[model samples]
Target: MAFLALQKDGTQRAWAAEHLWPDCTPYRAAGNLRSALCHARRACATPVVETIGQSLRLAPTVRVDLHDAYRAGDEVTAGLSPPPGTENGLIEALRQDLLPEWPEDWLVIEREQWDQLRLHVLETLAQQLQATHRFVPALQVALAAVGIDPVRETAHRIVMEVHIAEGNVASAYKCYQNYKDMLERELSISPSQRMRELVEELMPR
Candidate 1:
């Protein structure tokens, strides 16, 4: 239910009413929200919901996986290598999205959040891989991220930049084109000037 709510791109209220209580009438929906929270709390050891008047949110105490992954991504972006023992912890954090098997229509805001975080994790992982001269593996992670969220231009940009830095002009240009085509197809948008210039530099006349 939390994943359903978080997957949507809006406030929590809509998820409570829509996915959580698809059969609920407007008059009884608020009560249903409370019931759902109660049930979720019973099944989990932690507080799942925090009540604040008419709005109910995931409890402040929850340390969500995606949030942890974002932090790990940031650390990687800052060029911090994970210690040998900690690699599993960082990779484990990004290996899955919560409630993958559940399908719920809830919000547009959350989908964007997931996309942004996915892009961050992928780009960070790619950077780390490239730093160690693992070009093929870096591309795999970066490209997989782009596949997961085609509209996220940054994933492709990260791969392209890494390729350029590695002196693989061909790979950089290919990644840039892939990004450009994806953006145009998914969002009807063009690549940013920075992306365009890098790709152009790689292309031979």
Candidate 2:
């Protein structure tokens, strides 16, 4: 399924066959590709590969995270405001990965591009939602952005501040804890002192 997402539309299956089985006979490679693609579809529960005169595309119905991220990003660039509460969904809809467990291969390059676009668009949505005083929705978007890219400290802080402002100290602390744990466990690092200090402060009742 993921192959369809990563592959360029209209590429000859022979191109894919060659890559998948570099050492094998071209006939064998082409046969393997067909089998692999069929298995991929069943496993992912989507028809990710479509054939149109020896060319392929991801299934038309399979909405990819990268695609949604790009579309949402375009909408924002065109000054289209997202419906309130939908901003976070938009961010979440732009899933952190198209197929996270897929083996690391040439697709890493495409993954990196998707990663960048998803973060950029989600962060933009977070900021826009915040400006409109849709604090809960904004917080969700910000949190999603941070999840997709934990290095985005600004997005994390924004979620914290929004929660505190809304008098949801528990939620604010949970956000802090989750992010703090992720960094510490995954990267062997701690949250910034500024983040630590902010979480201790109380919100107005």
Candidate topping lDDT = 2
TM-score of each: 0.62, 0.60
User: lDDT per model, in order?
Assistant: 0.68, 0.74
* Alpha-carbon runs more than 4 Å astray in model 1: 1-19, 22-27, 33-67, 77-79, 92-101, 165-167, 181-189, 203-205
lDDT of 1 by residue, 76-180 (tens): 767787667766577655555655565655435555666566667667778788878888778777777777776766777877877787787887777677767
The stretch of ten residues in a row with the least summed lDDT in candidate 2 is 1-10
Cα TM-score of candidate 1: 0.62
The sequence of per-residue lDDT tens digits that candidate 2 reaches over residues 1-205 is 5555666454678887786577879999999988997787788765667788788777777766656666777787567876666665666667557567877464677778877777777777777777778887787777777778776677788888888778788988888888888888888888888988897575444
Q: Top model by TM-score, which number?
A: 1
RMSD for all candidates, in order, please: 5.1, 6.0
Residue pairs clashing in model 2 are none
- Model 1: lDDT equals 0.68
In candidate 2, stretches whose alpha carbon ends up further than 4 angstroms from where it belongs are 19-28, 34-54, 58-66, 83-88, 153-205
What root-mean-square deviation over C-alphas does model 1 reach? 5.1
